[model samples]
Structures are given as structure tokens and as C-alpha cells.
Target chain A: MKQLKIIKIGGGIIDDAASLAQFLHLFAQVDGPKILVHGGGKGASEMLRALGIAPQLVNGRRITDAATLDTVTMFYAGKTNKAIVAGLQQNRVNALGLSGADGNVIRAVKRPVREIDYGFVGDLTPAGVDAALLGALLGLGLTPVICAITHDGQGQLLNTNADTIAATVAVALSEKFVVELHYCFEKNGVLLDVNDDNSVIEKINLTSYAELKEAGIIADGMIPKLDNSFDALSQGVSKVIIGHALKINDSLKTVLCLN
Target chain B: MKQLKIIKIGGGIIDDAASLAQFLHLFAQVDGPKILVHGGGKGASEMLRALGIAPQLVNGRRITDAATLDTVTMFYAGKTNKAIVAGLQQNRVNALGLSGADGNVIRAVKRPVREIDYGFVGDLTPAGVDAALLGALLGLGLTPVICAITHDGQGQLLNTNADTIAATVAVALSEKFVVELHYCFEKNGVLLDVNDDNSVIEKINLTSYAELKEAGIIADGMIPKLDNSFDALSQGVSKVIIGHALKINDSLKTVLCLN
Candidate 1:
């Protein structure tokens, strides 16, 4: 199977244009068929404030109202996505920007109201991914830059988590490719000591990941990301890497496997 | 040659949600391979005003600054384009939204600074369009929903004219498909009597268009649109239709031809 790398970039890299461009320049250097999934950065929140839409949260968790959904959709799927696509194009990559609604690529279910209504938020599964179409796009040599906005296939666009999108897409494409999912952020890698960026773990398997969790080194924010990573690994994704966005080509990164 | 319809819609239908939805339903019912090109409606301006970006116009032409470009990119490529695509998907049409940057479908040159400097504005010709890829996309049964945003292939996104993009793509794809370019707006068609909506000139040849201009009926905004239509017709587009967005399936529209 051909090797395919799927990289997801979040707020830390995206909030700054210079860092984002530097990351994209580095990303372009990493060879092979690749897909980029990007998160909604602080720009959306700032824009919301500019638009006078009060931040609505229930029990400290953000809620995506209709207006918030519209704003984020524009920010993620429009400005940031196109900027990244054009940037990649400048690097001589034929990048195609997409919202899930573009090809119905990832049909998600609007998150059902449990304790709090997450209005217009989407929860998706790997089965909802259109792996064949993505494969066809890759075959055409067009790199896809996907935004974190998916549709319910019934005309509603939903805000989604970029990490989950990358992992789900990786799992779905694992059948056709040796999928390696990378979660790129601010730090060097998953740190052995949370305060030291250079305290990289190097590698972590299922047992080590459990030990790390028990040791409380991989707690809080790192927990969900690693859990999502392990979920992908268990479901056929070859490997999951966590590293700095700008240092993607470097050797110092944490690689997770089911081994 | 296989028949293809490339439709362009502007502010009249797009500004109203109910009207835009009605138009999308009408668009889905149009037979054969089709492409939809959309103009930036009042939404961009409203958002800009809300965000305190004062409208900058030099000699009646809107000048796109960096901030304006960002806002418009989000509005057109992100919000409007995705909304249309999702709506079409709801109507059972597999619509793929695109910016000119996507697939590098339309590489444009930033308008040169001369007497008036149009910042971040793209000027493009039919030759700049990637006809083969568009034809391939159409072959895959995907309806392309293009926003009026092009890139300079050097990481710059330019605000382009939707009508021009529509006509240029029509001319470019004419080599592979019998292209019928449709311009949808408020009126039924080119009005024979400026005051009467019922007075639509159903068929317009070049000779009559010249006479209409001489008579002042086809003056102002209609001039550029008709000029673009004839240019497309002369280049290779089989025909150009000017009509109302709602009455797309009806015959109450003006059809422009060379002969």
C-alpha cells in the first residue's frame, strides 16, 4: 500500500500567519500523498467579539449557536482554508480546499442534546468518510486542505473537531494506504515532563500510554488527543505522531502505535 | 459534444435566504452537467460594516484591501459557497464548491496599479482556466459551485468578477462541452421596456444588441454583462441565457447567440 500522511494543525500554529506559513512551507517539504485538516483558531472568537456575538457556553463548554456556526464556517472553511490552499499552491502543491459539504466527504450527525445543546456541532464516525473520493483526489495529485466544518447531508453545516476528522479520515483510508496521522501543535512533542518542551517521550505504545495516564503526565488536554490517536491506531491507522507544527521534518517527535 | 450549463447568480437572489433556497432547488432540477458561479452579495458588505471596515471605493469601483479581501474570502468561499453546496446536496445534487485557488482552476494576475490601484483584485482571461480538470470534475458527476475568488499562484487570493469567471470558464470548457452560460438575477430577462417586467426580449442576436445599446435600453450594468456574454459566445460558448433565478426551468428568458 502506498504511504499517506494525514496532518492536523490546531490553534497554536494557525493563530499566527508567519508560523502558519512556516509550517506550510515545512509541510510542503514532507513528500508523499498528504491531506491537511485544520482547526478553527482564535480568529473565530475574535471575529465573534468584533461582530458582538457574546460567547455562549454551558458549564464551561462552548456552544455553537447558529450565528457562531456561520462565523466559524466562514473562518475555517473560507479564509483560513483558502489561505492555506494558496500558500500550498505557492509551494508548488496543487492544494484543493474543502468543507465536508463540498463533496459530501464527511457526513456527520448533529450532536444530540444531552445535558447541554451543542447547537450545530457535529459528531462523526469513520464510516461517514468518503474514502474512495479522497483516494481519487489523491490519485489526481491534488492535495486536499480540509476545514473543520462538516455537513449532516441534509443542508446543515456543523462545527467539528479537527483532530477527530483527521483520525476518522485516516482510519477510513487505512484500507487503501499505510495511514500515518500527525497532530501538530506548539510543543516539540508529547512531553515526559509537562513543563519541558524538550522532554519528548520519543515513542509510546498502549502500555506506555496507560502508564503515562496513570503517572498524570498525559492528563487534561493531552488526554483526549492521545485517546483519539490510540483509537485511530487500534482501527488500522499505522501510526500517530504528535509534534511541533514548524518542526514536522525534524526527528524529535512522539510516535504512538498499538505495539 | 456533451451539453453543459454554467449558471451565475448575483445579489438579487443571494441576499434573501428563502429566494436563494428557491433558486438552488431550481438549479438542481436543471438537467445535464452544470456549474454554478456566485457573486458576493450584500452579506459581505454587511459583515464588513459590522466589523467596522469602512467601504473604500475609488472612482465608483470597490478597492479590495487586505482586510476587505479577508472578509470577502470568508463570506464568498466559506459561508455563501458552502451554504449553496449543502443546499444543493439536500436536493440530491452532488455539488463541489471551489475557489479559483482550488485545483488552481483559475490562476489570475493581480490588477496592475495604474491610474487607480485595485488592491488584491485579479484580472483573468479564458486561457488561464484549467478546462481539463473542470471537465474531469464534471465527468465525475459533480456540480462545481465556484466563488468569485482567484489566486495569483503566489499565495495571494484576489477578488474576481463572478460574471467574468462564469463567462471565462464557459469559454474554456467549450472545447470539451457544449457550454450554455446562464446569468440569473432579478428580472425575467433583458427588458424591451425598462418599466415593464413582461417586456422581455426573448432572443438577442449581436445586431439587435447593438441596436438595443443605441436605443439606451441596454445601458449601465447590463452593458458589461451582455458584453461578457457575447465575448463568450464568439469564443466558443454555444449560447448565453439571461433570466430570473426562479424561472430557470421556464422558457421566459433571453437567449443570446452570435447568428
Candidate 2:
């Protein structure tokens, strides 16, 4: 199988223009057919504040009301995605930006209202990803840069999680390629000591992952992230890497495996 | 040669929700391969007012400053483009939204300044439109929905005119297909009397266009639009149709030919 790397970058890198440029420069050097999935930065909230819309939170969870969804759609799908695409074009990489609505690449269902209404938030599964279209795009020598906006087949746009989108797309494409999912964030790696950035864990298999959870090393936010990573590994993903966005090409990062 | 239609819709139909929906419904029924190019709606100006940006006009021409470029990019490429794509998807058309930066589809140069500088505005030629890529996308059964934002083939995104882009794309694709260009707006067609909607000129050839201009029937703002349409017709476009957006499938329209 051909090797494919799918990298997910969060706001830590994207919010900083210089950092985002440097990351894209490094990403352009990765030698393979790859995909880049980016999360929303702090730009959306800043624009919302400028537009005089207060953050609408219900029971401590942010709600994607109609206005919020519009603001974020403009930010994620419009400004940031185009910026990255233009930058990649300048770097000589043929990058194509995508929202789920474009070509129905990711047909997500709107999250059902249970206790709190999330307005336009989208929920996804592996089946929702269009592997054939993505494969054809890659075959045409175009690297796809995806943003965090998805759509319902009926016409509503929804705000979705970028991490979940990356993992879901990775799982969906793994059947055709040896997929390596990279979660690039602010930290160096899964650190042994949270305060000490240099205390990076080299590798973690299923046994070590269970021990880390048992020993309370993996708790709270990291728990869910690593849990999803392991789940992808079991679902035909060849590997998962967690590291700083700027240090993606560096070897000093945490690697996860099913073994 | 195969037949292809390229339709350009401006703010008249786009600003209204019901009209835009009706137009997309009519557009979905257009036979054979088709492309949709949309202009920025009034929503962008309203958002600018809410965000406290005054319009900057020099010599009666609106200048696209840095802030104005950002706002327009968000509106044209982000919100409006995605909305149209999702709407077309709902109508069972596989629409793929695009900026000129995507796939380097339309590489534009920044407009040079003589008296006043139009910051981040792009100028295009037929050579800039990637006809082969667009043809391949159509071969894949995808309809390209383009917006008025383009890139300088560097890292800068620029605001462009939607009408020009549509004409240039039609001329470029005419090499492989019998290209028909449609300009959809509020009016029924080219009227003999500007005030009479029923006095529509059904067909206009080169000779009739010259006689109409000599009689002062086509003057003012329409001179430039028709001039460009005739230029496209001379450059290989098979036909140019001017009609109302909602009445696209109707027989009440103006057809321009080089004969």
C-alpha cells in the first residue's frame, strides 16, 4: 500500500501567522501524498466580538446558534482556508481547500437536540467521508486542505470538530493506504511531566497506554484525544503521532501503536 | 464539440433568499456540463457596517483596501460560495466551490496602480483559467461553483470581478467545448425601451448590436457589459445570453452572436 500522512493542526499554530507560515513551509517538505486538516483559530471569536455578538454558551458548552455558525463559516471556510491555500500555492504545492459542502466530501448529520440545543453542530462517522472523491483529487496531484465546516446533504452547514474530522477521514482512507495520523499541537509530545516540556515519552503501545491511564498520567483532555488515537489504530490506521506543529518533521515526538 | 454553459449571477438575485433559492433550482436543471459563478451580495456591506469599516471610494471607483479585501473574501469565497454550493447539493447537483487559488485554477495578477491603488484586487486573462483541470472535474461529474476571489499565484488573495471571470472561463473552455455564456440579473433582457420590460430583443447579432448602439438604445453602464460579451463571442464563445436569474429556463432572453 502507498503511504499517506494526514496531519491535523489546531489553533495554537494557526492563530499565529508566523507559526502557521513556518508550519506550512515544513509541511510542504513532507515527501508523500498527504492531506492537511486545520482547526479554527481564535480569529472567529475575535471577529464575533467585533461584530457585537456575545458568546452564547448553554450549560458551559458553547452553542452554535445561527449567527455563530455564520461567523465561524466565514472565518474557517473563508479567511483561514484561503490563506493556507494561497500560501501553499506560493510554496509550489498544489493545495485545494475544501469545506464539506464542496463536492459533498463529508456529508455530516446535524447533531440531534437532546438536553441542550447545539443549533448547527455536526456529528460524523467514517461512512460520511467520500473516499473516492478524495482519492481522485489526490490522483490529480492536488493536496487537499480541509477546514472544520461540514454540511448536511439537505443544505445546512454545521460546525464540527477538526480532530474528529481528521480521525474519521484517516479511518475512511486507511483501507486504501497505510495511513499515519499526526496530531500537531502546542506541546512537544505526551510529556511524562506536564510542566516539564522536555520530558517527552518516546513511544506508547496499548499496554503502556492502559498503564498511563491507570497511573493517572493520562487524564482529562488528553484521555479523550489518546483514546481516539488508539481507536483509529485498531481500525486499520498504521500509526498515530503527537507532537508540536513546528516540530512535525523532527523525530522527538510520541508515537502510538496497537502492539 | 460538447456543449457547456457558464452562468454568472450577480447581487440582484443573490441578496434575496427566496430568489437565490429559485435561481439555484432552475440552474440545477440546466442540461449537460455547467458552471456557476456568483458575485458578492449586500450581506458583505452590511457586515462591514456592523464591523465599523467605511467604504473607500476614489474617483467613483470603490477601492479594495486591506480590510475591505478581507471582508469581501470572507463574504464571496466563504459564506456566499458555500451557501450556493450547499443549495445546489440539496438540488441534487454535485457542486464544488472554488476560489482561483484552489488547484491554481485561475492565477490572477494584482491590478497595477496608476492614480489610485486598488489594494488586493486581481486582474485576469484567458491564460490564467485552468481549462484542463476544470474539464477533468466535469469529467468526474462535478459542477464547479466559483466565487469572485482569486489569488496572485503568490500568498495574496485578491478581489476580482465575477463577470470578467465568467467570460474568461468561457473563452478558455471554448477550445474543448461549445461554450455558452449566460449573464443572469434582474432585467428580462436587452430592452428596446429601458422602462419597458416587455420590449425584449430576442436575438442580437453583430450588425444589430452596431445599429442598436448607433440609435442610442444600448448606452451607459450596459455599453461595457455588452462590449465584453461581444469580445468573448469574438474570442470563441459560441453564445452569450442575458436574462433574469429566476427566468433562466424561460424563452424571454437576449442572445448575442458574432454573425
Candidate 3:
């Protein structure tokens, strides 16, 4: 199988122009077929505030009402996505930006209203991915830069978690390629100590992941991220790497495996 | 050559939700491979107002300063483009959206500063378009939804005139497709009597188009549109149609031909 890299960047890097430019410069240098999935950064919130739409949150997750969804869609799928695509073009990378709606690449279901209504949020499953379409795009020598907005295939656009989108796409494409999923953020890597950035775990397998959790080193927010990472490894994704967005080419990162 | 329909929609249809949905349905029902190009409507201006950035205009044309370009890029390529794509997907059209930066499909030059500087605005010729990539996309059975945001291929994104985009793309793809460029707007067609929608001329050949311009019937804003239409026909586009976006399937439209 050919090697393919699926890199996911969070808001921290996207929120800063200098960091994003540095990251894009590094990303353009990455060899082989690659796809970029980006998160909705602070720009959306700022726009929401500017538009007089109050930002709603429940348990650290955004409650994407119609107005909020519209704003985020504009910021993420529109501004940020195009900026990155144009930047890549400057570097000679043929980057095409996408929302899940574009080419129906990712179809997602609106999260059900249980105790809390997530409004227009989408919950995606592996089957919802259109691997063939993505494969065809990659075959076209076009690097897809996907935004976190997906559609229900019935006219409704849903706000999805970018991390899950990256993982799902990586898993879907694993059939044709050795997929390397990179979750790029502000941190160096998955840290062994919360206070020390240099306390990188370096590597964590299923066994060690459990040990880290029991030791409370990988508790709280990093827990869901790691769980998601391990899940991808279990489902045919070659490996999941978490690291700083700017230092993607560097060796200082945490690698997750199912082993 | 295979037949391809390149339809361009201005802000009138895009600004209204129900109208946009209706137009998307009609677009999906059109036969053969197609492409849709859209203009930035009032949404960008509304956003600019929200962001407290006063819009600047010279001779009724926007001065696309850095701030204006940023807002317009978000509105056109991001929000409007995605909405159209998602809507088309609901109609089962399999629409793939693009900005000029995506796949370097439309390489533009920053408009030269002359009497006025239209900051970050792009100027394109037919030769700047990437027809092969578009043909490949069409061959994949995907309909392209293009926004009026193009790149200089060196990093900067420029706000382009949507009508020009429609015409240039039609001219570029004329090599592989018998192209029909449709300029869909709020009106039924170009009115022989400016006040009467029923006064559509139905057909205008090259000679009559000039006479109409001289007679002051097809004057003002319609002049540039018709000029663009005639230019496309001369460049091998099979024809150019001007009509209401919702009434695309109907024959009550002005057809411009070289004959």
C-alpha cells in the first residue's frame, strides 16, 4: 500500500497567523499523498460575538445553534479553509479545501437530543465516510483540506468534531494506504507530566495507555483524545501521532499503537 | 466535444434561502455535466458591518482592501459556496465546490493598480483556467460549484467578478465541451423595455447586440454582462443564456449567439 498522511490541526495553531504560516510551510514540505483536516478556531467565536450571537457551551462542547453553525461554517469551511488552500498553492501544493458536503466525502447524522441537545452537531461513524471518493480525489493529485462541517445528505449542515473527522477518514482510507494520523496541536506531544512539556510519553500502546490512565497521567481531556487515537489504531489505521503543528517533521512526538 | 453547462448565479438568488433551494433543485435537474459559479451577495457586506469594517467603493465597484478581501473570501468561498454545495448534494447533484486556489484550477493575477487599487482583487484571462482538472472532475461525475474567489498561485486570494469567472471558465473548457454559459439572476431575461420583464428580446445575435447597445435598450449593468456573453460565444462557447435562476429550464430567456 502507498503511504498517506492525514494531519489534523487544532485551533491553537489556526488562531495565530504566524504559527499557521509556519505550519503550512512545514506541511508543504511533507512528502507523499496527504490530507489536512482543520478545526474551527477562535475566529468563529469572535465572529459569533461580532454578530451578536452568544456562544453556548455544554461540558466544553459548543452548542451549535443555527446562527452559531452558520458563523462557524463561514469561518472554518470558508475563510480558514481557503486561506490554507491558497497558502499551499503558493508553495506549489495542489490543495483543495472541503467540507463534508463537498463531493459528499463525509456524511454524518445529527446528534440525537438526549439529556442535552447539541443543536446542529453531527456524530459520524466509520460507514459514513466515502473512502472511494476521497481515494479518487487523491488519485487526481489534489490534496484535500477538509473543514469540520459535514452535511446529513438531506440539506442540513452539521458541525462535527475535527479530531473525529480526521480519525474516521484515516480509518476509511486505511484499506488502500498505510495511514498515518497526526493530531497537531500547541503541545510538544502527549506529556507524561502535565507541567512539563518535555515530559513527552514518546510512545503509548494499549497496555501502556491503560497503565497511564490508572496512574492518572492521561486523565481528563487527553483521555478522550487518546481513546480516539487507540480506537483508530485498532481499526486498521497504521499509527496515530500527536505533536506540535510546527514541528511535524521532527522526531519529538508521541506515537500511539494498538500493540 | 461533450456538452457542458456552466451556470453563474449572482447575489440575488443566494441571499434568499428558499430561492437558493429552488435554484439548486432546478440546477440538479439539468441534463449532462455542469458547473455552477456564484457571486458574493450582501452577506459579506453585512459581515463587514458586523465586524465594524466600513466598506469602500469607487465608482460603485468595491475597493477590495485587505480587510474587505478577507471578509469577501469568507463569505463567497466559505459560506456561500458550501451552502450551495450542501444544497446540491441534497438534490443528489454530487456538487464539488472550488475557490481558484483549490487544485490551482483558476490562476489569477492581482488586478494592477491604476486609477484605483482594488486590493487583493484578481484579474483572469481564459488561459489562466485549468481545464484539464475540471474535465477530470467532470469525468468523475462531479459537478463543480465555484465561488468568485481566485488565487494568484503565489499565496494571495483575490475577489473576482463572478460573471467574468463564468465566461473565462466557459472559454477555457470550450476545448473539451460545447459550453453554454448561463447567467442566472433575479430577472426573467434582458428586457427590451427596461421596466417590462415580458419585453425580453428572446434572442440577440452579434449585430443586433451592438444595435441594442446603440439604441440604449441593453445599456448600463446589462452592457457588461452582454459583452461578456458575446465574448464567450466568440471564444467557442456554444451560446450564452441570461435568465432568472429559478426559471432555467424555461425558454423565456435571452440567448446570445455569434451568428
Q: What TM-score fits each model?
A: 0.98, 0.98, 0.98
Stretches > 4 Å off in candidate 1: A58-60
Give Cα distance to truth, residue A120, candidate 2, Å: 0.6
Kindly report which residue stretches of model 2 are placed more than 4 angstroms away from their true locations once superposed. A58-61
lDDT of 1 by residue, B121-223 (tens): 9999988899998988887778999999999999999999898899999999999999999999889999988789999999999999999999998999899
- Give the per-residue lDDT of model 3 (tens digit) for A1-259: 9999999999998999888888999999999999999997898898898889999999999999998988889899888999899989988899999999999999999999999999999999888998998999999999999999999999899999999999999999999899999999889999988899999989999999999999998989999899889999999999999999999999999999988
CA error at residue A223 for candidate 3, angstroms? 1.3
* DockQ value of candidate 2: 0.86
Residue A6 lDDT (model 1): 98
Q: Taking the tens digit of each residue's C-alpha lDDT, what string does model 3 give over B1-259?
A: 8999999999989999989999999999999999999998888888899889999878877889888888898889878998999999999999999998999999999989998888888999989999999999999999999999999988899999998999999999999999999999888999988889889888999999889888988888888778778888989999999999999999899998999
DockQ of each: 0.91, 0.86, 0.86
TM-score of chain B of 2: 0.98
Among all candidates shown, the one with the greatest DockQ: 1
lDDT of 2 by residue, B102-136 (tens): 99999999999977798888999999999999999
